[model samples]
Target: MKKHNWSIVLLFLLFVSLSISCKKKQPVDADPPEGTESNLVSAEVTGSYNSNQLRLLALAAEYDAAVPFIKYDVSFIKINYKTTYKGNEIVASGMLVVPKNMPTAPSMISAQHGTTFLAAAAPSNVPQFAAFTGYELLSSAGFITAIPDFIGYGASKNVIHPYYDEYHSAIAVRDMLTAVTAYLKKEKTAFTERLFMIGYSEGGYVTIAAQKTIETSPIPGLSLKAVAAGAGGYDVTSIVSAIIDNGTYSDPAYVAFILNSYNITYGWNRPLTDFFREPYAGRIPVLLDGTNHASAISDQLIADPTALLNPVFYANMQNSNGELALKAAFATNSLLDFVPATATRLYHGTADETVFFQNSQLTFDKYKASGASKLELVPVPGGTHESTVLPMMLNALPWFQSLDK
Candidate 1:
């Protein structure tokens, strides 16, 4: 078995994490209609930035001039919105970045962030840093951007993050967009009603999930224009099998996260010891408690799946009929079946190890075979999971700008 490089995985999480709603007011005199109530719970202005100030911030963040320069001053607002979780309604939080003084009605983007365990790294919590790297900077480029905290953090922090769960992930993005649309309309922020999606890694999975939901179900007042997803684990079963079969994976933290998330999200209620080895299993709950960073968690885990996971559980996961519930969950959550109708581009680093480039390739091939003419696959030469992000952004931003009309 190849000894994986832990440092790169650590750096990937650190670098990506480092990088990467309101309610309407009720009338005093008369109550609003029952179904007419806004999805938006509340919005609070966090900060405002002028174009020049945003330009300097982008430069400091190392974004090249090839990317769109700051074109409009922007306001950052933290918003809470009503979104569903496992058939129950709950309030979730996100960051809404609205551009000021645009020449025309600006388009909107649901910018999803890569995976992060730390709550502080959630977009609404770290608005300024997110502004430049996550979604805020794009707002400065004149698009209204909404970055949802994705259920495990922000207002829904107590809930288990349904990592890689299709329905939960899709609803988080969809409802946030719905809430944002209501908020923008309430505030009289002019937007073109053209919606775009962008994300990398886990965000990439989320972008695709949201795109599929919107394209298929058709959200009222939310029209998806285009999307760019990079290095996502869309083929969930294949990715998990590869990890188990390969014996060693560079990022054990990710493996733990998925297992734990699946266990909780699916109501499997399996003990961590059923999946992971003793000491690591004992430590998993503490490691994933929304305070530790991914790097910190990775530091404590072994890279070899055989060593990190229980021998029986690992062996069972390899068999088709074994671990039936978990297998069903993985199959259900995988994004392989959908053929996106909207213009879409799947981006992947050819050398990416964490989520594997093959995941995207397989997805692109499937979509193409299903007759998705507007789909394209973009390979970032020599880009690893961490390195692929900047290049992906550089290419995606321009492409999104071209289609922004």
Candidate 2:
């Protein structure tokens, strides 16, 4: 009897151990997670604007109320659209706020959000730079303001928000613009015929992509008059190279974000073991969640890939011969390969930590060479990336206003 009891106990322990091990081995859900679309698809206009227009106006109001900013009569609209890349049904949502009692406003501004938050999420949160820029102020100032949630944030479908890829970002922008314009034209709400684009940080990069796409694609109802991009990641390769060469503290985490984005978008052509070893490989999923806390922690934990990880992983990443294919894949120019020669207002702080001011200069020079006559590169003196909005806007608003003529 005693022997039989001991055998049963041992078997139970073995079973429990196997279960624990299996749990540990389970893959993390790092890819884009799923989310439900908001029920507020369209709004009802009680006054002058029709139902669709009123809905956009209501959304803008909600957005204004959500954040502590000057209130504008804003409306919210949600769009359900499909993209080919992930076969995922995406939602392009944003706020459309027109000036009170304005008729035939000459211009529209599409405000793009920065790197840390989704465009739709920005207006609701105070910490987000987009909210501070007074987009509401812009609307009250008689500009038709349109803010998109990009591809992943808010109602946008899919999980992997493509980093600096202009194609996907531009598509989202174009679609949102189309929806808003259609709503306006259908309702006969007279507003700006000329369009303007504005973005900061990741948003700045997105604006560049959208401008390029509008110039290249045959998308209708897009009358881009002026574009303002500030502190944008114009050149991914150059930015990464600068981080590596300068030994900036944030390089590793930035690299980690890029690697995770690329790896998930274009999964490993080679074995995963060839690139990342042990802990770093395991942490990939955690780092790519697009959360503030995760980004901050990653910045501290990862300084240099070669120094932090094991020799095998470091060698694989640094090895020209071994990583030749992977390097080549990564070496492809994600930005600046397709910039439009549209009238542009570029802003950068001399002391930007994430995206160097030099990148902005290089982009300006390239745009000039590309026969872009209406380009203005404005450098904010003694300004860092974080504190650039007010000064950049002061420079941009006048220029944007001039485009109306």
Candidate 3:
């Protein structure tokens, strides 16, 4: 079920002379019994990293080579826990990497993952998936790193992923945190109550969503200290407009994915032929079947969004006058209305064609205008979505680290 490749950072960075390698070792994880509060279903070892390996990962993510480094050997333990999704309680799993030994009380980090289509590559299933890299890196730094599989992945593979549905996304992470705490207690692992949230792309959206949920309805035990969101489609409406106005987008399949998701989740019941053109109309149902790898569809589709969509549908997608159903549904997840009080940094590449850099700029402006005191947008000049990955992560790790100091 291995899917995401967070290690893409290395490959991306290496394009400009990045060269590094390392090894690591650790004891296999001990099995734990199913417990309460979001029960800990299992904790199995995935991989280990020596100090050098940890340092390599840090460097690959563009972490400052000058920052004093620590060598806390790290290992991945996939934890399956109980969480609610779309109102039904279900078992979900995620990656939890920890140092072989603990200090007094280490900080906690919720490393929300970016978009992933394949179930196997989820944090809980495979240790080497690149998405686990950040978790491992943080764990080596003495942070209890948690990465939820979200829905439609990990233990809940059969469940439909809510995509940008912020409500369900927030609940899933919250429940996962509850499960992590319960498991840590059962293991007698020492960790602080301080929590940080960070992620990229879809993960970024989930991070913001969770921050909003915590602020709007503060959780008693979990306190959020800081947040970092990178290249997420925060302004949902603006994203739609970008697709329509540009006549093309970096990923046309996303349009189909979103349209189909809204139809199924909201019961719009809009048939494929109503929106898509030709064989694509017939092919989209299976392409978006949730069973295919995300790229399986995107790779097959052309970047020209207009080519994939029917004329009427494309025209309607241009603005609010048409397709009221989707507009309203996307509105529910838009971050424009939510003003995060926590020290939050929004990072986006000025050259990002996929998610659009303007998303962050608009969010920062609205937050400031709406009276949010602790919000800032960090722009990575000339960085594309992929190129910005390491920089965004590097920015977040230190910002979170600074909070404790």
Candidate 4:
């Protein structure tokens, strides 16, 4: 009789323990607060360039005019488009470029910018860097170009730029296209009927997110023809592991940007004082502006981001920090998981040092294994992440041209 009583007591305790554990493991609600300014703002696109601001505007417009015309004929026009998402007015400022004379093209390609310190503010100057080499090639091939400065980057008003939040990035892409389409319909502009997206690095992830959103959302009059992602840091979990394991060659600005972005998004996670540890954090922002300057690379502004944090700080980062929250957000808003079993083109350089090519390969394999019928993985041999854009564009040009046929 005593044995039976003890067994019952033990079973009761076990049940209680399991209940507590399950409660603790329950996920926090991932839905962002509605009616918040970030959630309600509409996107507006405009050209702030004028003759009086010629130098800056010229600098801004240089990429559209110069880069695409390098090997083929291309011309671009600057325009502003606006739209609302959620409940707030959001503004997106960008350029629209197409082949010099092809007015009746069948497809439009939206190119996303990578992790430049300037974000998309200096779009005109970005294409010169090997990072954006594909933009020109895509434009030259008669694909209409639409690029957004992701919220908080260019003219958009926001405190922190969402680093890896696919929803925010995807929305930016979607709104830009919506605005452009509206403009075309209103003006009766002759252009392509199909919509395609292309992006690299940070932009590549955004491209994937945008494609997923478009496929699922109720945005009328928009059709995604195809998508191309190159060297995108798709899996943030893996990227964070790489940063923690290999502290060398990590960009300090990226770490700062991530920390800042997370703190802004989830202030409850960590205190602001926990960030900007020392002279390094204080001075890092100034150094970021020089990211594209030739002298900056030699100064070793890039270093292991993990090295800057102690174990306690790192532990805090992993726990309540926005990085994990961002991941949860992605999982909750996984538009890509439901992507049609269509083939989306993916390109990655085997020797990419920035974002691992294996990551791209894994994503491609996952999609293919899942019965994704419309997927293509193109390997760029003898190419690194930064050097493959031009070649990828060259390879994609024929494909872009085929959309018309």
Candidate 5:
């Protein structure tokens, strides 16, 4: 996974255009909208930025003089909505961005964010650094952007984040879009009703998972237009298998996060020692408690699977017949079986070490062979896991804009 801070800087620059004034734009707080309906619990305008401000920021950040032109002022709203988790209904939170004063109804994009270890980095919680998030920049491009905090952040912070669990991740997004639609309608805001999805890293996984959910189980009045996912681990089983086989992987925190998340999310309750070595096992729970940064956790843990994992557990993970329950969990969460039903672009840095590039390769090949004609695999030449995100957006945004037209 890309370091959280790097992703923030890169994504913010990619979307917001860079500027020194990128410092926190004080939110223009508004009274919470009245008459909340359906799954929408509450909505409040947190901040607003004009086109000129974005343009200046863009000019400051642009490598060349050319930057994405700002067209509309954007407003960010922090919304609390009802969604399901572990089969129980719970309230979730996300950042909602709307274009102000558009002549025509703007389309919607549910932008899922990459893996973030700090609770403060959750979309709804980052108003102080909202410009850096990049989702708001999509709003300036005239799309209503819905960015979920997923569970385990914002309103549902008490719950352990489901991480790559398909159902939870997908449902958080799907339900947020639903709640946003209802809220917009209630507020008498005009929107196109057309929808798109995009994300990178864990966000990418959530994007695809949400697409599968939206496609397989129809959302009323919300047809998915298209999606672009970059460097996502769509093939969980294959990813884990490769990690064990290779015996070395970068970003031990990511691997640990998945293991710890699955243990809690699935009710496995496996001891950390079952997954990691001595001091590391004891250190992991504290690291993942929604506090430490990803790099901090990684610094504390070794990257060698043999050194990090228990010998028996490591051996079992590799054996086809071993770790059946864990394997089943991975297979259950993997996206390999589902071919996308709508236009889908899977982007990967050819050099991504965090989530192996093969995951996308295998997924694309499977989708193509399974007759997904609209599917496309975009390999970013020499792009590492972190470097691929910007190019993916540069390529994807135009494709999405063309479709929107």
Candidate 6:
């Protein structure tokens, strides 16, 4: 395995994580020992699901009858690997689904999953329904699927999840690849050098971020064949800007997750009152303490997202420069600033209220202007953020298969 540039990564994270949420703090690289790679801590055969099971997932995810029933049974493996979370070495768990009888070397598909609050719903825990359609459809479609539970989930759920922060989650994906590689080699499974990635919602953001990490710091022996990112907040700056601009956002928990994760990740240690208004301010930290479900967090905060935010912080969001640390972080995570060299496809719905459709549009335009000819945006008609996930994925899976062919 190739070691990533830790100093570079830490600098990026530090600049992205501001002192108050814009001042550049001293770059502190808390990365575990350089030699600490993905070591398999445990392994288990969860269960084997048949073609019918996969088909049911497709139907449930997207009523696409065109989804093929390959009849290939896939056995799931729960795997734990060593990875650094905010510089701390932790054993993180993820799931791998192998085609029961693949004749040739299967290709690698690192499907970064969307946001989920339940620890039991982590990929390693629920192979069948962890993220539902992404795991089942892609894993059963003849590719070896690997999904990381991410930090603060699965085996390491005790810590707060780094929501919307791409740096740590991308490292988790990279280390999980190491674990998956070890498992494949130990089992004597044949796999080609090709690697593909797909992510939706939060997954989409991670996919693009991981791809960027791979680009800035290439992973040895891994060739990213293609990327299908759907409904992701690719341009974190723009998305965060939308949140600030909006009056009443549908999902307030996402905002809370961003604040909480950034606080812990940057070591700011600011209390909830620093970001939120009273009552809700005191209530948010409890909701975000890695215990309450995302929906529960949403139910608890019904006011306009702006209403829930501190007046000073809400107004600071307007500054695009280093005036606000949160805005700086957003600019750092935004994907539009750089062009993807790999063949990439971004999918989103036109009517996405949750993520706002303009994110994809602006990103696509930016890519086009950057001379990235291979990148294209696929728009789903009348699809909101929630509604477009499956539809975008249905297209993404086949698109990945096409890339392989």
Candidate order by TM-score, highest to lowest?
Answer: 1, 5, 3, 6, 2, 4
lDDT of each: 0.81, 0.59, 0.74, 0.57, 0.82, 0.75
Candidate 6 is scored at a TM of: 0.85
Off by over 4 Å in 5: 1-37, 55-66
lDDT of 2: 0.59
RMSD values for the candidates in order, in angstroms, are: 5.6, 15.0, 5.3, 19.5, 4.3, 12.0
TM-score of 3: 0.85
Candidate 4 residues 51-147, lDDT tens each? Answer: 2222222224332233433332443344344534333566645555544455454367888877665543434322222223236345554566776
In model 1, the number of clashes is 10
lDDT of 3 by residue, 1-405 (tens): 122355455634432231123222342233443543435566666565566655655555555441244458866677777777767778888888777776557888998887776556677754343344355566676788888888777788876577888887888788788778777776787778899988888889999988888888865467889998889899888887877788567677777777776676666677888888877888887776555666688877777877878889888877559988777888878988877899999989999988999888888899999988999899999989777877776677777878964
Tens digit per residue, CA lDDT, model 2, 301-323: 56665555556755555555655
TM-score to true structure, per model = 0.90, 0.72, 0.85, 0.71, 0.89, 0.85
By lDDT, the candidates rank as 5, 1, 6, 3, 2, 4
Query: Compared with the true structure, what per-residue lDDT tens digits does model 1 show for residues 121-191?
Result: 77887432322344577887778999998988889998989999899899999988877877777766778
Q: Which predicted model would earn the best lDDT?
A: 5
Q: Which stretches of candidate 2 lie over 4 Å from their true place?
A: 1-72, 78-89, 103-106, 117-136, 269-281, 290-295, 308-333
- Per-model clash counts, in order, read 10, 14, 7, 21, 1, 4
Question: Which is superior by lDDT, 2 or 4?
Answer: 2
